[model samples]
Each structure stands twice: as structure tokens, then as C-alpha cells.
Target: MLKFVLKRLLHMIPLLLGVSLLTFLLMSLAPGDYFTTLLQNPQISPDTVARLKAQFHLDQPWYVQYFYWFKSVLHGDFGYSMAYKIPATSLIFARLWNTFLLSFVAMIMAWAVAVPLGIWAAVKKDSWIDRACSLIAFVGLSVPDVLLSLLALWFAAATRWFPVGGAQSPYYDLLTPMQQFWDRVHYLILPALVLAASSLAGIMRQMRSNLLDTLRAEYVTAARARGLGEGWVIWKHALRNAINPLLTIFGYSLASLLSGAFIVENIMAWPGLGRLTMEAFFAKDSYLVVDSVVMATALLVMGNFIADLLLAWSDPRIRLK
Candidate 1:
């Protein structure tokens, strides 16, 4: 198991390098500068523009600038954001937690709901409940997250029950500690639902299909013939094998879920790394852009690692390999 983990970790290094290098190159090659918008003000003189450009090392050759970028990155200096007038690392860290919180919650909720529903659907086969769940899953898969968010916002408006968007209401800061917790969670409802909807669809459908296949396998039928309790036969034996296929994709889902967080954050004004990345990109704050990408990549790698560990724990075959 340790060897397998180590091997996977080894493989991740080059993947991260490729991601960073490609991101850096893409950002560099893009046609724009931090100064482009700033210099548009007729009141700002060329001297000021030149000074600003030089201060941020925009005057340096691309290669030289990137070399220094690599150096600073190694030393943990993620550089400054001209747009926000703050260090890139600090800004990113602030948003990172929010993004992480939302993504993790949404993914957990989706899996929790999906796995059971999937198992039930599989056990029932083409029955009405299965057909209805399939239809719901189909609609969820088809619907755009943006539209879902908008619809959720409308629902909140109509009901006046949940805060429409943002991480918290204006009264959040004024609330007592316990109320604050609940308020924030309330704010999370819409965004979390939006983020998890499609994921729930996919997970449910995948697990249902997987469980059905496992239930049909010879081992499962043999277990039933041996007078194994129905619950134990299905939940213990069939589920264990059925879940293996789901586990493989779960790692990829973690990374994709974070990527999806970007869009959801922007729509809901959740104040997360996704929104920060967008702001940095528009401002041509390459320092922030590069650092944020690297940080996101690191997070994604960590998520994948956790999934690998979970997979190993659940499957003895994986441990041996």
C-alpha cells in the first residue's frame, strides 16, 4: 500500500509540473498587461506608468521574470497583486478556505444522497421508484448549474426562507456565535445544492449501474444461496464490490468539483478562490494567477491522494497492488 501510494505520489510530481508550466506559459503568452487598464486614464503620465511597470518587474524579459517567479515561488513569496494591493499568497489563502468548505460539503452531501438512492434504484431494477429516480437524475444531469443557481435564487426570493446568495447575510456579523454558524450554513444551502446537483446525478447513476452489475455477479448469487441474510448479502458483499468502480472515479470527481467551484462561486458571490482567480486573471496579475493555479493544483493533488488512501482501505486487492 505504501509502495503504491509512493508510486502515485511520484507520478503526481510531473503532472503538477506540467500543469504549472502550461499555466505559466499560457498566462505569459496572453496579450495583456496589468498596466493596460491603468494607463488608460488620461491623467496618469507615462513616467508613473513606467514606474508601476518596473515596480512589478513588467520591464524584465519574460524568461527572466518567470525565473524569478519560480525562485520566489520556491521560497514561498507568491508576489503582490497590483489589483488588490496585497500579497498573492495571503489573498489566495483567505479565499481557499471558503472554496474548500463549499466544495467539500457539496461533494459529501452528493455522495451521501447518491449512494443510498443508487443502491435502492439498483435493487428495484426498472420499477417505478427506479424510473422516477432515473428521470430526476436525467434532469439534473441536463440542467446547467448557472440556471440551477438562478432558479434557486428565485426560490429563495419567493419563499424568503434562505438568503439568496453570498456566504452570509448582512446580519451575520451581528449574530451570536451559534446563530452565526446557522446563518452561514443557511447561506450555503443554495450554492451547495447548485454545486452538488449534477454530481449527485452522476454518482447516483454510476452507483446504480455498478450495484446492479455486482448483484448479478456469481459471487452475490452464491452468497444468497448460502442463506446469507438479504441485508448482509447486498450491503456487505455486493456493495463492497460495487463501490470499487465508484471509488476510482471519485478521485477525479474531487478535482473536477473544485474546478466547478469557480463557476459556482462567481454566480453566488461566495467570495472564494474561484472569484479571486477570476479577478486576478482579468487584472493580468500573473503573480496571483500563477500562485492560485499552483495552489489549486496542490489542493487537487491532495484530494486525489485522499481518494487513493480510501480506495486502498476499502479494497484489499488495491492494497496488494
Candidate 2:
């Protein structure tokens, strides 16, 4: 298993290199250079531009620039953000953490709701409960995330059940530790629900289908014949087998949450990597763009790798190979 993990980690080297290289090239080829925005103002003179260019190594050949950037990357430097006037590493990591926090909460909420509901739907297949679940799931799958988030934002305004936007309440600074916790939760509700809703529905639908299928399997029949309680047969025998697939999809859902938190982050006014990426896009901060892409890709790759290991552990049929 250790060897398998090591091998997989080693294999990611080339994939990451390809990802970085492609992002670098594509970002470099973008229509505007990082300095274009700075130069747009007539107040900035040519000598200043020349000095800025020289300082950023913009005057150098692209190869030389890439070489320097690559060297810095090896030293854990993500380069400076020309727009922000700050080191990329300093700002990016904090925002990345915010993104992670939001996405992680969303994933937890999604699985929490999805697994039980899916199991119930499967257990009660062909009944009213199952039919109702299917209808909700279909609507969830059909609703656009942006539209859903917008509706949720409006609902928050009307219901006052949650903050319409932002990561924490204004009173957070004055709160006690326990109060702070509750405040953050209060602030997170609408955004987390908005983020989790569609994901939960999808997972529930998939799990329900898989569980229903598993219930019909020969193994399940054999378990039932052994005089096992219905609950034990379903939860232990059927669910264990059925949930393997959900385990795999859960990893994908995890990756999706981490990578696709943009809409939710924006809707919540969350200070996160997605917001930074949007800013970078507008500024054409090529290095920042490439760095953000690399970070997101790395997170996804790591998520999948962990998921694979988890799947292998959960089902002995899937070994390290």
C-alpha cells in the first residue's frame, strides 16, 4: 500500500508539470500583460514603465522569465501580485483557506443530508417517499447554481433565517468564543445550504439508485436467508456494498466543492480563492492566474488520491493496485 501510494504520488509529478506548463503558457498568451492596466493611466510615464518592466523581468525573454519564476516556485514563492502589490503566497493561502472552509462545510452538509435520505428512499422504493424524493432530486439537478444561490439570497432577505452574505456577523469581533461560533454558523447557513442543496440532491439520487440495486442482489438475498434482522441486512450487508460507489463519487463531489466554490463564494461575499481568481482574470495577472489554477488542480488531485486510498481501504476487493 505504501508502495502504491508512493507510486501514485510520483505519477502526479508529470501531470502537475503539464498542468503548470499549460496554465503558464495560456496565461502568458493572454491579450494583456500585467503592466497594461498600470500603463492605462496617462499619469504614469515611460521611464516608470521601463523600471517596472525591468523590476518584474518583463523585459527579459519569456523563457528567462519562466526560468526565474520556476526557480522561485521551487522555493515556495508564488511570485508577487502586480495588482495587489503583495506577495502571491501571502494573500493566496489565506483566501485558499476561506475557500476550503466554505467548500468543506458544503461537502459535510451535502453528505449528511444525502446519505440518510438516499438510504430511506432506497429502503422505501416504489413508495410515496421515494417518489417525492425523486421529484426534489430532479428539481435540484435542474436548477442552475447561480439562480439557486440568487433565490436563496432573496429568501434569506425575506426570512431573515440567515445572513444574506458574508462569512461572519459584524458582531463577531465583540462576541465570546461560543458566541463567535454561533455567529459564524448563523452567517454560514444560507451560503452553506445554497452550496449544499444541489450537491446533496445529486448524491442522494445516486445513492438511492445504487442502494435499491444492491438490495436486489444475490448477496442481499443470501444475507436475508441467514435470518439477519432486516435492519442489519440493509445497513450492514447492503449499505456497505452499496456505499462503495458513493464513496468514490464523494471524492469527486469533494473535488467539485473545492474547485467550484466560485458561485457560492461570490454570493456569500466570501473572501476566497474564487474571488481572487475573478480579480486576476480582470487584471490579467498572469502569474496569479497560473498560480491559482495550479493550486486548484493540486487540491483536486490530492482529493482524488485520498479518495482512491479510502475506497481501497473500505473495500478489500480494491487493493492498492
Candidate 3:
């Protein structure tokens, strides 16, 4: 396992470098950069603009600029955010937790709800309960995230039941620890629900299908023939095998939630990496954009790596590979 993990980590280095290179090249193709608007300011002379470009290596060829940026990255420097006037790493770190919090909450909610409901649906196959779950999953899968976010905002507005947006109330610090926790939860509900709803459908459907298939397997029949209780046969034997695939899904879902959170965060004012990335892109903060992209890609790669590890652990057959 240690060898496998080390190999995956080693593989991540080249993957991140390639992603960063592609992002840098794409950003360069855009007409202007962070300093382009500065040139329009009559108060800022051409020399000042030129000097700024030189300072950031923006005046160099794309490959040369990438070389310097890559060199900085190797040394654990993610480069400066021209727009925020801070280290790109610091800016990303500040928002990274917020994004992680939202995604984590949503992921937990999704799995908790999805797994049981899916199992039940498969167990009760063709019953009204199963039909109801299917209907809910259909609606969840059918609705667009943006529309759901807008509806959630509208509901929050009309009922005053939830905060329409933001991660916390302005006076969050003034509250006691317990109060702060609930305050965060309260602020988290709308966006988290929005994010979770998007994922719950697919997971539930996959679970239902996997369980159904597992239930029909010859081993399940053999377990039943061995006089195992129906509950034990289904829950212990079938469920164990059925759930293995979802573990793989669990890994990818984190990165997907992070990516999906971008639109939701912007729409709902969640104040996360997605919003920061959007702001950076609009400002043409090259280094910041590159860093954000690299960060997200790393999450994706790591998520899959974790998934592979989980897959190997859950099913010993995979470890041999």
C-alpha cells in the first residue's frame, strides 16, 4: 500500500505540471493581462507599465514566463496575485477551507441520505416507496444547478428561513462557540443543500442499481440457502459488495463538488475558491488563475488517487494490480 501510494504521489507531479503549462498557455492567448489595463492609466507612465511587466516576467515569451513560474512553483511559491496584491497561496488558502467546508458538508449529506435510500429502494423494488425515491432522483437529476440555486435563493428570500447567501453572519465572532457552530450550519444549509442535491441523484441511482444487481447474484442465493436471515443476507452480504463501487464514486465526488461549488458560490455569495477563481480570471491575474487551476486539478488527481486506494482496500482483488 505504501508503495502504491508513493507511486501515485509521484505521478501527480507531472500531471500538475502539464495542467499548469496548458493553463498558462491558454491564459497567454487572451488579448490582455493583469497589467494591460494599467497601460491605459495616463498617471502610470509606459515605463512604469514596462517595469511592472518585467517584474512579473509578463514581458517575456510564454515559454520563458512559464519557466520562471514553474521554477517558483518548485520552491513552494505559487506566485503573487496581481489583483489581490498578495501571495497566491495565501489567497487560495484563505478560501480553500470555506470551499472544503461546503463541499464536505454536502458530500456527507449526500452519502448519508443516498446510501440508505438507495438500499431501501432496491429492497422494496417496485413499491410506492421505491417509485417515490425514483421520482425524487429524477427531479434532482433533471434540475439544473443554477436554477436550483436561484430557487433556493428565492425561497430563502420569501420565507426568511435561511440566509440567502454567505458563509456566516457578520456578527459570527460575537457569538459563543456553540452559537458560532450553529450560525455556520445555518448559513451552510442553503448552499450545501443545493450542492448535495446535484450529487444525491446520481449516487442514489447508482446505489439502487448496484444493490439490485448484487441481490440477484449467485452468492446471495447461496447465502440464503445457507439459512442466513433475510436481513443478514441483504444487508451484510449483498450490501458489502454493492457498496464497493460507490467508494470509487466517493473519491471523485469531492473534486466534482469543488468544481460545482464555483457556480453555486458565485450565485449565492459563498466566498470560496470558485468565486476567487472567477474574480482572478476576470482581472486576468495570470498567476492566480494558474494557481487556482492547478489547485483544482490537484484535488481531482488526489481524489482519484484516494479513490483508487479505497477501491483496493475495499476489494482485495484490486491490490494485486
Candidate 4:
């Protein structure tokens, strides 16, 4: 297990490098940069702009800049954020938690609802309950995240039930710890739901299919012949095998939630890494963009790695591989 983990970690290095290189190349193709807006200032001279570019290696060729940036990255420096005027790492870490919190809540919400609903639907296959779940899943799969976010905003606006945006109330600091927790959760409901909704349908459908297939397996029949209670046979035997595939999906879903958060965060004004990344991208903060992309790529790699570990642990056959 340790050897497998170390191998996966080693593989992540090249994957991250490739992602960073591609992001850097694409970012370079965009016109202008963080300094462009500064150039328009009447008080700032061309020499000042020149000095700024030189200081940040913006005047250098893309490869040269990437080399210097990569060197710093090797030493645990993520470079500076031109827009935020801070270390890129610090800026990213500051927003990282918010994104993680939102993604975590959304993941829990999705799986908590999806798994049970899927299992129940499969158990009652072809019944009204199954059909209803299918209809709901279809709607969830069909609706885009952007539209869902807009609808969530509208609902928040019209009903006044949930806070429309941000992660807490304005007076959050004054609240008691318990109140503060609930305050954050109150604000969390909308964006988290929006983020979870997009993935929930797919997971539910996958779970339903996997469970259905597992239930029909010869092993399930054998378990039944052994006189295992119906519930035990279904929940313990069938679910154990059925859920293995979803563990792989579970890993990808983390990265998916982060990517989806980019849009949901912006639309809902939720302060998170995604919103920060978007801001940096528009400002053409090259270092910040590279850093954000690297961070996201790391999350993706880690998610898959963790998933692989879970897959192996859950099924001994995989560990042998």
C-alpha cells in the first residue's frame, strides 16, 4: 500500500508539470496582462511599466518565464499575485478553505441523498418510486449548473428563506460560536445545493444501475439460498459490491465539485478559490493563474489517488494488481 501510494505521488509530479505548462501557454496567448491596466494610468510612466515587467519576468519569453516560475515552485514558492500584491500561495490558501468547505458540504449532500434514493429505487425497480427517481435524475442531468444557480438565486430573492450569496451574515463575527456555525450553514445552503445538484443525478443513476446489476448476480442468489435475511442480503452483500464502482466516482467528484464551484461561486458571489481564480484570470495575473491551475491539478491528482486507494482497500483483487 505504501509503495503504491509513493508511486502515485511520483506520477503526480509530471502530470502537474504538464498541466501547468499547458495553462501557462494558454494564458500567454491572451492579449495584454495584469500590467496592461496599469499602463493606462496617467501617473505611471512607461519606464515604470518596463521595470514592473522586468521585475516579474513578464518581458521575458514564455519559456524563460516558465523556467523561472518552475524553479520557484520547486522551492515551494508559488510566485507573487500581481493583482492581490501578495504571495500566490498565501492568496490561494486563504480562499482554499472556503472552496473546500462548500465542496465538502455539497459532496455530503449529494451522496447522502443519492445513495439511499438510488438503492431504494433499484429495490423497487419499475415501480412509481423508481420512476419518480428517474424523472428527478433526468431533470437534474438535463439542467445546467448556470441555470440552476440562477434559479437558486431567484428563489432566495423571492422567498427570503435563504441568503442569496456570501458565506455568512454581515454580523457573523458577533454571533456565538454555535450561531456562527449555523450562520455559515444558512448561507451555505444555496450555493452548496447548486453545486451538488449538478452531480447528484449522475451519481444516483450510476448507483441505481450498479445496485441493480449486483442484485441479479449469482452470488446474491447464493447468499439468498444460504437463508440470509432479505435486508441483510441486499444491504450487506449486494451493496458492498455495488458501491465499489461509485468509490471511483467519489474520487473524481471532488475535482468536479471544485471546477463546478468556479461558476457557482461567481454567480452566487461566494468567496472561494474559484472566484479568486476567475479574478486572477481576467486580470491576467500569470503567476496566480499558474498557481491556481497547479493547485486544482493537485486536487484532481490527489482525488484520483485517494480513489484508487479506496478501490484497492474495498476490493482485495485491486490491491493484488
Candidate 5:
């Protein structure tokens, strides 16, 4: 396991470098930049623009600028964010925690609801309950997150049951600790639900399929013939094998938890990396864009790595292979 992990970590170095280079090249290909936007303002003279470009090394060749940026990145300096007028690292870190919190909880909620529901649907296949689960899953899979977020906002507005947008109420700081916690949860519910809906639907469907296949295996029949309780056969034996595919899904979910939050976060006014990255993109903030992409790519690699570890742990055959 240690050897496998080390090998994966070694592989990520060049992978990250390739991602950063490709991301930088793509950003460079985009015509105009942060300074180009500033050029439109009649008050900002050409000399000022030239000086600013030079200061940021934007005046340098693309490769030269990339080298400097990469060097700085290695030293933990993510460069400056001209749009936000903050250090890129600072800006990203400030929002990182919030994005992490939102993504983690939403994914957990998704898997939590999906697993058992999936098992139940599989076990009671073709029944009314299965049909109901299928109907709900179809709705979840069909609805676009943006539309769902908008609808959630509308519901919050009409019913006043939840905060309409944002991560917390205005008086969050003044509230008692417990009140603050619930206030955060209240604000979190709509956006989290919006984010998790599609994921939950997909996971549930996958779980149902996997579990159904496992239940049909000869092992399950053998267990039944051995006088094992149906519950024991299903829960202890079938469930363990059925869940392997879901574990893989869980790993992929770790990566998407943030990237997938973009649309929902923007619509719901959640302060997270998704909204920040969008803002940076429109503003042509090179450092911010590159940093965000690199961060996301790192997450993707890490997610796969963790997934591999889980697979090896759960199935001894994996390690032997």
C-alpha cells in the first residue's frame, strides 16, 4: 500500500506541472487581460498601463511569465490578484474553508440518502416503493442545478422557512453558539440540497444496480440455502460486495464536490471557490485562474488516489493484483 501510494504521489508531480502549463497557455490564448480591461478607462494613461504590465511581468513573453509564476508557486507565493487587489493565495485560502465545508457536507448528505434508499429499492424491486424511488431519482437527474437553486430561492422567499441566500444571517455573530450553528445549518440546507440532488440521484441508481447484481450472485443463494437469515445474507454478505462500486463513486465525488458547486454557489450566493473562480475568469485574473485550476486538478488526483487506497483496503484481491 505504501509503495502504491508513493508511486501515485510521484506521478502527480509531472501531472500537476502539465496541468499548470496547459492552464497558463489557455489563459494566455484568451485575448486581452486584466490590464486590457483597465485600458478602456480614459483616465488610465498608456504609460500607467505599460508600467503596471511591466510590474506584473505581463510585459514578458508568455513562457517567461509562466516560469516566474511557476517559481513563485513553488515558494508558496500564488502571485497577486489584480482584480481583487489581494494576494492570490490569501484570496483562495479565505474561501477554501467555506467551499470545503459546503462540499463535504453536501457529498455526505448525498451518499447518506442514496445508499439505504438504493438498497431498499433493489431489495423490493418493482414494488410501489421502488417505483416511488425511481420517480424521485428521475426528477433529481432531470432538474438542472441552476434551475433547482432558483426554485429553492423562490421557495425560501415564499415560505420564509429558510434564508433565501448566503451562508448565514446578518446577526450570526451575535447569536448564541448553538443558535449560530443552527443558523448556519438553516442557511446551508437549500444550497446543499441543490448541489446534492443530481449526485444523490446518480449514486442511488448505481447503488440499486450494483446491489441488485450482488443479490443475484450464487454466493447469496448459497448463503440462503445455509439457513442464514435473509437480513444477514443481504446486509452482511451482499452489501459488502455491492458497495465496492459506490466506494469508487465516493472518491470521484470528493473531486466534484467543489467543481460542481460552481453554478449552485453562484445562484445561491454562497461564498465559495466556485463563485470566486467565476469572478476571476470574467476579470481575466491570470494568477487566480491558474491557481484555481491547479487546485482543482490536485483534488482530482487526490480523489483518485484515495479511491485506489479504499479499493485496495476493501478487496484483498486488489492488493494481490
Candidate 6:
């Protein structure tokens, strides 16, 4: 297992290099840059733009510029964000925690709710509970995330059940620590629910299908024939095997949340990496854009790697090759 993990870690070096290089090339080839916006301003002289370009090594060959950027990356410097007038690291990291927090909570909420609901639906089969779960899942799959977020925002406005937008209440600063924590939680609930809704549906359906199939298997029949309680047979024997495939989805879901959160966060007004990435893209902040892409790709790769490890652990038949 250690050897397998080490091998996977080693492979990530080339994968990450390719990802970073591709992002760098794509950004370089893009028509406008961070300076392009400044160029459009009437007051900013061309000479000033030239000076800024030189200062940031933007005039250098793309390949040369990449190496310079790469060097800074090695030293934990993700280059300066001209648009925000800050280091890319600082800007990204500040927002990264919020993104991570939101994604993590949303993921937990999704799995916690979906898994049990799926099991119940499968166990109940054609019962009313199963039908209800199916209807909810259908709604989840059908509704686009942007629309869901907008609707959630509207609901919040109407019911005052949640903050309409943003990561905190206006009274957060004056609140006690516990109050502050709850305030953040209150703000988080809407966006997290919005983020989790679609994924929860997909996961629940997948779980239901897998569990149903597993329950019909010969092993499950054998377990039943051994006079085991239905609960024991399903939970102990069937569920373990049924959940193996879900590990793969669990891995990819980590990265998908980043992209999905971009839309949800924007609509919900949650300050997170998604919004920052979008802002950086439109501003053509090359360093910031590259950093964001690289970070996302890294998360994706890590998620897959973790999934592979979990799958192997869950199913001994899937030994690392």
C-alpha cells in the first residue's frame, strides 16, 4: 500500500507539470492581459504600460516568463496580482479557506443525507417513501445550479430563514465568539444547501441503484439464507460492497465542487475561490489565473488519487497494479 501510494505520488509530478504548462500557454495565447484593461484607460499612457510590463517581466518570451513564474512558484510565491495589487498567494489563500470550508461542509451534508436516503429508498423499493425520494432526486437533477441558487436566495429573502447573501451578518463583528460562529453557520446554510442539492440527488440515485443491485446478488442471498436479520444482511454484507463504486465519485466530487461553487457562490454572494477565479479570468490576471487553475487541477488530481487509495482499501480485489 505504501509503495502504491508512493508510486501514485511520483506520477503526480508529471501530471501537475503538464497541467501548469497548459494553463500557462493558454493564458499567454489569450488576446488581452491584466495590462490590457489598464491600456484602455484614457489617462494611463502607453509608456506607463510598457514600464509595468517590463517590471513584471511580461515583455519576456512566454517560455522565459514561465520559468520565472515557475521559480517563484517553487519558493511559494504565486506572483503578484496586478488587478488586486497583491501577491497571488495572499489573495488566493485568503479566499481559499472559505472555499474549502464551504466545499467540505457541502460534501459532508451531501453524503450524510444522500447515503441513508438512498438505502431507505432501495430497501423500501416501490413504497411511497421510494417514490418521494425519486421525485426529489428528479427535481435535484433537473434544476440547474444557478437557478437553484437564485431560488434559494429568493426563499431566504421571503422567509428571512437565511441571510440573502454574503458570508456573515452585519452584526457579526459585535457578536460574541459563539454568536459569531452561529452567524457564519447561518450564512453558510443556504449556499451549502444550494451546492449540495444537485450532487446529493445524483449520489442518492447512484447509491440506490448500486445498493439494489448488490442486494440481489448471490452473496446477499447467501447471507439471507444464513438466517441473518435483514438489517444485518443489508448493512453488513450488502452495503460494504455497494459503496465501493461511490468512492470514485466521492473523489471527483471534491474537485467538481470547486467549479460548481463558482456559480453558487456568485449567486449566493459567498466569498470563495470560485468568485476570485472568475474575477481573475475577466481581469486577465495571468499569474492569478494560472495559480487558480493550478490549484484546482492539483485538487482534482489529489481527489482522484485519494479515491484510488480508498477504492483499493474498500475492495481487496482491486489491488494496485
Cα lDDT of model 5 by residue, 152-264, tens digit = 89999999998877888898899999999999899888888878886888899999999999999999999999999999999988999998888888888776666678888
4 or 5, greater by lDDT: 4
lDDT score, candidate 4 = 0.91
Tens digits of per-residue lDDT for model 4, 1-321: 678778888989889889999998999988887898988899999999999999999998888999999999889899999888989888888788898898889999999999999999999999999999999999999999999999999999999999888888999999999999999889998899999999899999999999999999999999999999999999999999999999999888887888899999999999998998899898899999888888878877787888888888898788622
Whole-model lDDT, model 2: 0.83
Evaluation by lDDT, superior candidate among 2 and 3: 3
Per-residue CA lDDT of candidate 3, range 43-109, in tens? 9999999999999999998889899998998898989999889889888887877988888899889
| Local error of candidate 1 at residue 47 (angstroms) | 1.3
lDDT of 2 at 76: 95
Instruction: Give the lDDT of residue 10 in candidate 5.
Output: 94
lDDT of 5 at 96: 70
Q: Evaluate residue 276 in candidate 4 and report its C-alpha lDDT on the 0 to 100 scale.
A: 86
RMSD in order of candidates: 1.9, 1.8, 1.5, 1.5, 1.7, 1.7
Q: lDDT of all predictions, in order shown?
A: 0.85, 0.83, 0.90, 0.91, 0.87, 0.89
Provide the TM-score for each candidate, comma-separated. Answer: 0.93, 0.94, 0.96, 0.95, 0.95, 0.94
Writing each residue's lDDT as its tens digit, candidate 2 over 210-244 gives: 99899999999999999999999999999999988
> Could you tell me which 10 consecutive residues in candidate 2 have the lowest summed lDDT?
23-32
> Candidate 6 lDDT, tens digit per residue, 1-321?
789889988998888778888888888887867787788899999999999998888988778778999999899899999899989998888788888888889999999999999999999999999999999999999999999999998999999988898888887899999999999999899899999986899999999999999999999999999999999999999999999989989887887787889899888889888888888888888888888877777777887898898899899899896
lDDT of 1 by residue, 1-321 (tens): 678778877978788667777777788788868897867899999899999988888888676777777778779788888888988778889888888899989998999999999999999999998998999899988998778877877888899988766887787778999999998899887788889886899999999999999999999999999999999999988999999888877888888788788888887788888888998898898888877887788888888788778878888877534
Q: Which stretches of candidate 2 lie above 4 Å from their native place?
A: 169-175
Query: Of the pair 2 and 4, which is ahead by lDDT?
Result: 4
